[model samples]
Target: MKTGRRLTSYALNYKKIILVALFLLTISVGTDLAGPFIAKNIIDQHILGIESVWNETTNGKSTAEYQGEFYKKEKNFSDNEEKGKEIRILQVGTKFVFMDEKLEFDGKRTFEQGILTVQKGDEKVNYNAKVLTNKELMAFYKLEIPGIIKLLIVYFGLLVISAIFQYGQKFLLQKSANRIIQKMREDVFGQIQRLPIQYFDNLPAGKVVARITNDTEAIRELYVTVLAQFFTSAIYITGIYAALFILDVKLAAICLLLLPILYGWIILYRKFASKYNRVIRSRNSDINATINESICGMSIIQAFRREKETETEFEKLNTEHFTYQNKLLSLNALTSHNLVGVLRNLVFVAFIWYFGGLSLNPASVISLGVLYAFVDYINRLFNPVQGIVNQLANLESALVAGERVFSLMDEQGEKVSTKRIERFCGNVTFDHVSFGYKEGEYVLNDINFEAKQGQTVALVGHTGSGKSSIMNLLFRFYDCQKGKIFIDGMDIINIPRQTVRNHMGIVLQDPYLFTGTIVSNVSLGDPSISREMVEKALKDVGVDRVFKNLENGYDEPVIEKGSTLSSGQRQLISFARALAFNPAILILDEATSSIDTETEAVIQEAMDVLKKGRTTFIIAHRLSTIRNADQILVLDRGKIVERGSHEELMLLKGKYYQMYELQKGNASLAG
Candidate 1:
C-alpha cells in the first residue's frame, strides 16, 4: 500500500492522460465483444430457417423435401425443439425464399410477428411468426455488415489513441524523471558539503557513490517502468475478464479459477525476489568500491606485488553478486511459469466443459458460430493475465528503489549556514581544545594555540602529533569538544562557514588537479579573479617557466588529473590556485615534503615571496624549513611540550632538537 500511494502521487500529476486512456479502453472492450454476438445471429437466422428447392422430373411419382436435412447435419441448431413450421408452395415450378425476417432455431423457426409481412402480387402469407426476444434483437445487430463496421471503427480508434498516449507518456516520463534525478544529485552533493570531516572517515566512498548514482538512477527508472506497465496490465485484465463474461458466464467462472493460484505464486515470489535484489545491489556497490580503490592505488598495489591478492578479493564479491542475482532470476521465472501454467490448465478445463457438454445431451445446444467466437475469447484472457503479473513485478522493483532514494533525500547534515555573511580578522586561536572522531579516545586533548595577524607560527611535530588536528579546528572542519575556537576574537560558530573559509587558503602535501586548462583550476572558487591575476599567481609561485614551456601555456588541458604534468608541476599549480584567491591567512601543511630538491628550492622561493603580508601557519617536519619562522611550537601527543625560536629550541635540547639532530644525520648519510 505504501508503494501504491507513492506511485499514485507520481501518476496523479498527469490525470488528464489517464482519463483519456480509460475512456478508450472501455470503447475497445465493447467493440471486442461485438464479434461473438454476430456469429450467433448468422447460425440461428440464415442457416437453420434456410430452405432451397429445385424442380425435378424423375418418375410419375415425385417427391418434395426441404433442405432442413443439411442444416441438421451441420449441427447449426439443436435437434430437440421440434420441427420448424414448414409451408409448401402449391405452384408447379419450384422457388426458394431466405428468412429475411430474423429467426432463431431450437429445431424450430421463430421470428417477430405483425412487424414484417411477406406478399406475392397482393396475396399475403397466412403464417404468423413468433415475436423477437431481447437476445435475438442484440444478436441481429451484430449479424449485419453495418454493425460490424461500427465496431471496427471503435476498435481502430482505440488502437490509435493508445499508441498516442504511449508516445506522450514516454516523453513526459523521461522529462520529469531527469529533472527529479538532477535535483536528487544536487541534494546529495549539498549534504556532503555540509557534513563533518569525520563523516567521510566512517563511511566508505563506494557506499556514498552507490547512494548518489546507482540508487538514484534505479528510483528514476522505477517511476518510468511502473507508470508504463502497471496501468497497461490493469486495463488488459479488466478488458479480458469483461469479454470472457459476455461470451459465457460459466466459462468465465472456470477461467477465473486460476486467478487465486496465480496471485498466491506472485505474493510468494515477490517477497523473496525483493530481498535477493537488495542483496545484489549492496554487493554490487562493494564491487564498485573495490575496483575504484584498486585503480586509485595501482602504484602501491604493484610495488607490493598484491595483484593476485586483489583479484582473489574481487572474485569473492563477484561470486556473491552472481549468487544473489541467480536467486532473484529463478524466483521471477518460477512465478511467471506458475501463473501461465495455471491459466493454461483453466483454459483446457473450460474447453473440455464446452465441447463435452455439447456431445453428451442432444438438448444441450449452442450455435456453431457462437462456439467459434468463444475460442477467440479464451485466447484473449491469457494476455491480460500475463500482463497483470509482469506489471506487479515492475511495481515491486519501483517500491524498493523509491525507498532508497527517499532515504538519502531525508538525511540531515551539519547546521552551518543560517546567516550568509559575517565579519572576521586573521587572528586565530584554539583554547583548551579536545577532539575525537569517535566518542572516546581523543586525538587532540587540551590543545592551545594563537596566531596573530601577520605572524609566522610554525608547528614542529612528528607524524600523528596533532599538527593537522589544530589546522582542522582552525578551519572548523570539526568543532572542538572541550573548548572554543575563535577567529578574529569572534566565536567561529557565529560566523557562516564560507565566511570563515574566505579568510584562509590551504595547500596540502598532495594536491589534486581537475581535467581542465591550468588557468581554470586556478580560477575556481574566485571566478572574479582575472586571467592576468592567475598568470601573476603562477609567476609568484615560480611555475612561470613550466607554463611557458607548454604549447598552449595556461590553456593546456590537464587530462586525467594532470597526468601530463609532473608531481612538482601539479603542486605548483595548486600553489598558484591558492595564491590567486589572495587570502589573508595561509596554511602550508607539510606542503613541500614531497618535492625534490630543485622543485623544493623553487617552492621555497615562492613561499618567501608570498609570506610577507599575510599571517602563515606552517606544519612541517624539516627543521630547516621553519628555521626563520617568527615562533616555533613543538607538540608531543596532543599538548605543546616546547615553544621558542629555532636557536632557543636547540639550546633547550628538547624533542624538537632531538628530531632535528636525527634528520640532520640521515641527510648527511644520504649525501
Candidate 2:
C-alpha cells in the first residue's frame, strides 16, 4: 500500500536501532534456551544415573494358599497374629522406606525383630548380618554447583538485555511515529491551502477535516504498530526457527510445518481486512461530514426545529460505521481461532511423535531429560510465529491507510506558473473572460471589464448573475477557461498565485476572525505591522470605543469566527484588517449585508477612508450603497446590459431603475 511505503520510509533512519534490537533479541532467545538446557542437566544428573544399583529385602514369606482363600474369619487373636506376622506386606518394586532400624518388627506376632535390647549381664555387642537379594539397574545422581551458577548468570544478563531492547524499541518507534504524523498533517493541510477554490465548492469542510485528522491518524497507526510489528515479528520468527533447527532438527521440522499454514491464513485474513477497513474509513469520513454540518449549522437547525432529522441522518452514518467495524472484528476472530487451533494440535502431535520414538528405541541413549526439553522448545518455537500471524491483519489495515494518504498526497495541485510576472500596476482588465463550473454552461460568458487606478467600480447584479464570479476571477481563485485576465497590462496567468493574492484585499459577507486578541486579528493582514498600527486602523474604523469598554482595549480577546461579537462589530474589525494591509486593490463581497443600519453608517466612513487612491470593486444589493461609485455595471445572466451612474440608469427606466424603485419602496414601508 502507498501509505505503508511512505511510513516505512520513516524507519529508514532507525535502521541501526532495529539491528541492535535484533541482536539483543537473539541473545535473549539464547538465554531462554539455557533454561531448558539447565532443566535437562538437573533431571539427568540428579534423577537418573547409568552406574547406580539397588538392593531390596523381605522380612517374611508369601502366603500363596491364603491368596486363594477369601477373607477367612479371624477366629482368634493367635490366628490373626500368626497370619499377620507370616504375611510379607512388602513386594517387588515397592517403594523403600527410610527410618531407624529400631522400628523393625519380627514376622511373629508383631514382635521386635532387631532392636537395641540392653541386657544387664551380657554386654551389648555389635552383631550384623549381610544378605543379598535382587539388584535393580538404576541411575546415579550428581549436582553441579558451577552449572547452576552459570544458568543464573545467563538469566540475569538476559533480563538486562531484554529490558534495554524493549525500552529502546518503544522510544525509537514512538519518535518515528511522531515525525511521520507531523509530516502527514503538514502535507494534508498544505494541500488544502493550495487547492483551487472549485475543489472545495461542493465538498464538506468536515470530510476534509476527517482526512486531515482521522485518515492521517490511521496512516500513523501503520507506522507505529503495523509497519513496525510486521518487520520485528518476521525477523523474530526467522531467528527463532533458525535457533530451533540448530538445536534439534527433528523438532524444528515439526515446527516448520506451521509456517506455510500460518502464511495461508494471513493471506486469507488480509484480503478481508483490506476490504472491511477501507469501508470503515470511508464511512468514518462521511460521519465526520455529517457532524461538521450539524455543528456548523446549529443556529439554522435551532431556528427551523430540524434537530430530529439531523440526528437521524447522523445515526444512519454511525450505523454504517459500526457495521463495518463489527464485520472486520468477526473475520479477525475467526482467523485467530483457526490458526491457533491448528498450531496447538500440531504441537501436541509433534511432542508425542518425538517422545514415542525415543521410548521405542531403548538403545538410542536419548534421555528422558532431553525429550522433556525438546517438548518445551517446541512450544517456544511457535510463539513468535503466532505473534506474526496475529499482527498480519494490523499490517493489512495499515496498508489500506497508507494507500489513502498517499493517494491524497499524489493528487494534482494547482497548475504551476512558469512565466513569472515581476511588475504590476492597478490597471485591471477582463478580456473576453469566460468560465463555467461544468462544461457548456458558462457562469460568466464573454465577460469584459476594466478598472483603472483610483476608480471604484460597482457590480450590481442579482444572486448567481456572475457578480461574485467576476471577483473570483480577479483573485485568480480560478483561471478563466476562455480568455485572459490582465493586471497592470500583464496577463494574470503569468503571475504567480501568491503574487496576485498578496496584492489584493477582500472583505466577504461573513468575515472570518481567528481566536486571538482583537489587535492580533486585525494585524494578521500584515504580521510585520506594529500593534500601534493595528490600533490606529481600528480607531479609523470607529471601533475604538468598543475596544475601550473591554478590560484590555486593543488586546480584547475574540472568539473563533468572532462569535462573541455582533455582525457589525466583526465587519468593522474586518474593515480595519483590510485597511491595515494598504493593498493596491480591494474588493467588497456583500460586506455590509449583516451589519445594522447604525453600524453600517459608522463603517461607511471607514470604508470611504480606506477606498481612496486604490482601485476597488463593490458588490452590493442596496442601490444606495453603490450610488456614489464612479461607474455602475448591471449584469444579467453573466452579460453586462447596463453601465452608467445611478441617476443615469434611473433616467433610462431600465432593469436597474426598476430594481432601485422596488428596493426604495420596501425601505419606505419598513421605515
Candidate 3:
C-alpha cells in the first residue's frame, strides 16, 4: 500500500474522535463565516438604512419626527398600511441632505444654496434640499440604535460560539493525533521484535532507533500540524468562496483562478522539495548511525587518538545534512509566503478593476455593505491559502518519513509463535549440513555430527572454522541451506523457530544485559520464573560469591550491556539466565575466554554441577577446558578433520593432538 493510505489507515483506527473533531470544526467555520453576512445586514438595513425614502406615518414606534412631521423609513412601513408621499434623505459627499421631492436620477450629488444637483454620465437633475444639523441627524440615527445593538449582540454571540467550537475542535484533533502516533510507534516497535536477527545485521542500531523516534516524530507532526492545517484551510477556503459567490458571482469566479495557480505551485514545489527532503532524511539517519558508532567505539577511538579523524568523518555527514536543509529552506522561502503574497495582490487588483468598472454605471453601483463584505471575504480568502502554502514542507516531510517507516514495516519477517513444546531428550544431529550467511560461499561444508542424550560434546577450532556457525544452526538462528538437522529424531526445520528453541539456551562470549536489576535480566520478566527460581539459578551459576560484595545482591541494577559490571560478573549473570530457563540443550560459545583464571574455575565448577542429564555443546579455543568431554571434534576450514575423546585423539597424534600440544607448549612458555 502507498504511504498515504497506510497513514490514513492508522488514522481510521481512531475515526470516531476525529469525526467528532471535524464536526466541531464545521460548526466553528460556519459560525465564523457568518460574520461578514451579519455585518452586511447591519450595515445595509440599519446603519445605512437612513438613506432610504421616508414616509409620513401616524405610528409612534420606529418613527422619526422631521420638521414637526412624524415619518418612518420605507423599510419600516408595514405592508398594506397607510401610505404617504415620499421624501428622500441622501448623503452628498460628507454631509447628509434632506430633499422634499425625489430627483429623476441619482448619481454624483452636490447640494448648494438649498438645491440638490444629481448627475449620472450625461444626465442631470435638480431638487430642493435641506441640510440637517448634527442634532437633527442624531434623531435619524437614534431610531436605528436599538436594531443595530440587537444585530451586534447576535454577532458577538456567534463569535463566542465560534471560539468555543474552535477550542473543542483543536483539542480533540490534537488528542486524536497523539493517540494515532502512539499506536503507530507501538506497531513499529512490535515489528522490530518480529524481524529476524539477520535484518539487524545490515542496519545500525541508531538508524533503527531513528525510525522509531525521529521519523515517527515527523509523522506525528503530520497528523497534528500538517493534516490539521490542511483540513482547516480546506474548510475555511470553501466557506470563504461560498460567501464570495453569494456577494458577487463574477468576482468569486475570478478568485477561482487562484485555485489552479496554488495547486500548480504545490506540484512544482514538491518536485524540488521532495528530492531535497529525501536526501536530508537519509543524511539525518547517517548522522545518527555515525554518532552511535562513535559512542560505542569511543574507547578505541580515544585510545588510538583518532578523535580528529572521527570528528572529520562526523562533520562530513553533518555538512551534507546541513546543505540539504538550507536547500529546503530556500525553496520554502521562495515559495510559501511569496506565492501567497503574489496571489493576494493579483486578486486585489482584479477586485479593484471589477469594482471600478461597476462604479461608473448608476444602476451597477453596489451598496456600501455589499462592497465591505466583498473586500472582507477577499482578504479572508488569502488566510487559508497562506495556511496551505506554509504547511507544504511539513506535508512532504511527513510523507518521506512515512515512506521510511512503512518500508521497514514492509520487510519480510517471521511470525513469532507462542506455541510451546515438550522438552527435547537432548539428542542433536547435523546430517550432511552445509550453510553460509551469503549465497555461493559455504562457511560449513558437509558437517555431520551427533550429540546423544546426556552427552557432552566439545568443538575445538580457530576463528572462522564453523564452530559458532554450528551452534547458530542448532539454535535455528539461521537454517542450513542443505541437509536436515534433527533433535530427538524430528527435523528441526519442520518446527517453528520459537518452538525449536524452547528447550535450548546459549551463553555468548560477550554477554548482553538489559537495563534492569540482575534478577529481572535473569528472569527476563517471564511469569514462569519466580524470585526463588532466579536466586537458585544464580546460586547454581556461583554468582553468589562473585556478586556478594554488591549492595543489592541479585536485585542489583545492571545498565545497558552490563557495562558497569566486570566481564566475569556479566558472564555469570548470563549463565544464571540460561540456567533459569533450564534448557535441555546448552551451548556455551567460548564463555570463559575473556575471564580471569579464578573466574574461569568458578564457571567450570558451575558447569560440572549444571551439566547433569543435559547435552552441552562447548565452542572453546582453550584445549585444556574440554579435555574430559565424551567426544571432541577438531575442525579446520569448515570441515571436521578429527573426532574422538581427548585421550584417544592424543594417542592418535593427529590434528587434535597437534592442537593440544601447541596449546600446552604456549602455556609452558608463559610459565
Candidate 4:
C-alpha cells in the first residue's frame, strides 16, 4: 500500500483532467439521485393521491349542500389540525352552484375539462377542481393525467442527462489512465538505464522487461478499472445516503452500520489478496524469464537433447502461476462480490420489514410513496457496494503491480553528473583498484596499471582471471570497491560515465547488432557518421569484397543479432564500427578470435591503421597477436602474475612463458 501510494503520486501531474472527470462524475450522480424523488412525486402528487369520495345532503328548493372530502394545500399538514372534514357546497343562484372550497365568488359557475369557470359580470375566471367522477383525474387531489405525463418526461430527462455525464466521465477517466501509464513507463525505462551492471548480471532480462511492460500495464488497469470503479461507487454511496437522510434521519443512521462492516471487509480482503497477488505476479515474471531464456538457449538445449526436461521445468512454473491465480479467484468469490450481494439482499429485507411495521400503525403517518422510494434508495446504495466489490480483483492486481513498479524505480543506480565532456585525452590509469561483483570475493585486487596516450597495452589471461573485470571497471560499468580510476588525470567518479566513455571504444568477444542495415550497424545510428564515413570504415576493415556480392552492399539488411551473417562477417562489421567512431582509446576483447588466420592476415594492416595513435587494450588467448604490444600483463587469479614486453616475459620463464609455449604447440597441431 505504501508503494501503491507512492506510485499514485505520478497522477498528481495530470490534476486538470482528473478534476474535470471527478466533476462530471459528481454531476452524473446528482442526476441519478433525482430519479427516486421524481418517482415519489409522481406517485404522491399525480398517480395515487385521489382515493376519498364525499357524499352530502341539504334541504332547500333548488339548493343542495354536497359534503366532500377536504383537501389540504400542504401534503404534510398536521393530522391533529383536522382529522376529517367535509367540503360544503350549496346552490345560491340559478346556476345551482353551492360553494367552491378553495375559491368563492357570487356568480354563476360551470365545470369544463376539470376547470370550474365562473362568470362574474363581464369577467370570467377559472379554478382547478377535483372531479370525483372524472376518470381523467388520476390523483385523489388536483393533479391531472396530462401533468403525470410531463412529470414522466422530466424524470426521463434527468436519466438521459445522467447518462451523458456518465459517458463523459468514463471517457475522461480512461484518457487520464493512458496518460498516467505513459509517464510511468518512461520513468521505468529511464531507471533501467541508470542501474548498475551487477543489477542486470543478477536479474534476468525477461523480468526487467516484465517490470517495464507487464507490471506497468497492470498499473494502467488500476486507473481505468479500480480507481474508476472506486470513485464512481463512492459517489453513488454518498448520494444514496444523502437521499436517505433527507427521507428519514433514523433509518439513514441505521444504514451507516453497513459502512463499517464494508470497511472491515475491505481491510481483511486486502490483507489476503495482496499476499496472493504478490505470488501471482512473481510467478508471471518467472514465466516470462523462463520463456526468454529458453529462446536464447534453444541451440544448447537441442544439442543436449533436453526437450523433455525443459518442458517439465516450464510446466512447474506455469502450474505454480495458475494455482495462485485460483486462490485469488476463490478469495474474491468468498469475500467481496458475492458477499456484497448477500449483504444487499439482507439490507433490502430489513427495509421491507421496517416499512411494513410503519404501514400497520393506525395513527403513525407514513406515505406509501416514501416507502417505495426508501426501497429504491436502499437498492441504489447496494449497487455501488457491489460495484466496488466487483473491482476488488482488479484492484488487488493493480496494487501489487504498483508495488513492483515503484520498487524498481526506487533502486539506486549510478549517479549522473551534470557535466558533459566533449573531448579528453586517452591517458588512462587504475591506481590500487580492488573490486568484486560480490562482497568479500574480489575479482581484481590492487590492480595498478596505466595506458598512456597512443600506447598499446595487452591483457592476456586465462578465463575468469579478471581481464573483462578490468575492462568493466575502466568503462565504469561497475564502480571499484577501493581506489580511484583516472581518465586524462580526471577522477572518473566525478565524471559522468557518458563523458568518460566519450573517447573510449570497446569491441567485445561477441559483437551485438540491432535490426537494421549493414551501414546502420557500422554507424550504430550515430548521426555524426555519414554515408562516406560508413563506406570508408567498411572498406578500411578489408571485408568489402564479402559485402560486394550483395546487391545493396552496405545497405543489405541485417536481421536481429545478425544471425544471418557469419561470425567472421559480424566481427568485421564490429571492427568497422569501432573504427568509425575514431575513439582516442580502443579496447578489443578477443576481437579477431572469430576470424580465420587468412582473414586476420587480410585485415592485419587495417587493424594497424585502426589501432594507430590510440591507447589500446587487447585481450586475446592467441599469443602471436600481442608480440608487438608495448606491454603485456598476465593475470592469475585476480593478481597480475607477470607484466613485461613479450621478449621480457619470455626471458622471465614464468606463467606467461608456460601459456605461450602451450598455445604455440596448439597452433602447430591445427596447422
Best candidate according to TM-score? 3
Q: Each candidate's TM vs. the true structure? A: 0.79, 0.83, 0.98, 0.86
CA lDDT, candidate 4, residue 419: 62
Cα RMSD to the true fold for all candidates: 9.4, 12.7, 1.4, 8.8
Residue range with the least summed lDDT across 10 consecutive positions in model 3: 99-108
Clashes of each: 1, 4, 0, 5
lDDT of 1 by residue, 624-665 (tens): 889988889898887899988889999999798899999999
lDDT score for residue 261 of model 3: 94
Candidate 1, pairs of clashing residues: 111-130
**Model 3's lDDT to the true fold?**
0.91
Q: Arrange candidates by lDDT, highest first: which order?
A: 3, 4, 2, 1
For model 1 the TM-score comes to 0.79
Q: How well is each residue in 409-461 modelled by candidate 3, as lDDT tens digits?
A: 98988788899989999999999999999998999999998999888899998
Please report how far candidate 4 places residue 568 from its true position, in Å: 1.8
- 1-671: candidate 4 lDDT, tens digit per residue: 48766756877878799999999999999998998998898886655543222222233221122233234323334455432333323222222222235444434567765566766556677765644432322222333456678889998999999999999999999999999999889888988888877888889999999988999999898898889999999999999999999998878888898899888888888899989999999999999999999998999999999989999999999999999999998998787667877787778777777776765554455666898899899888888898887788888888888888888888987655546566656889999999998999999999998888888899999999999999998988888999999988989887778777777788888999889999999888889889999889889988766565887778899999899998888888888898888888898998878878877776677867777788989999888999989899999899888999999999999999999999998989989
Residue 604 of candidate 4: its Cα lDDT? Answer: 71
lDDT of each: 0.69, 0.70, 0.91, 0.80
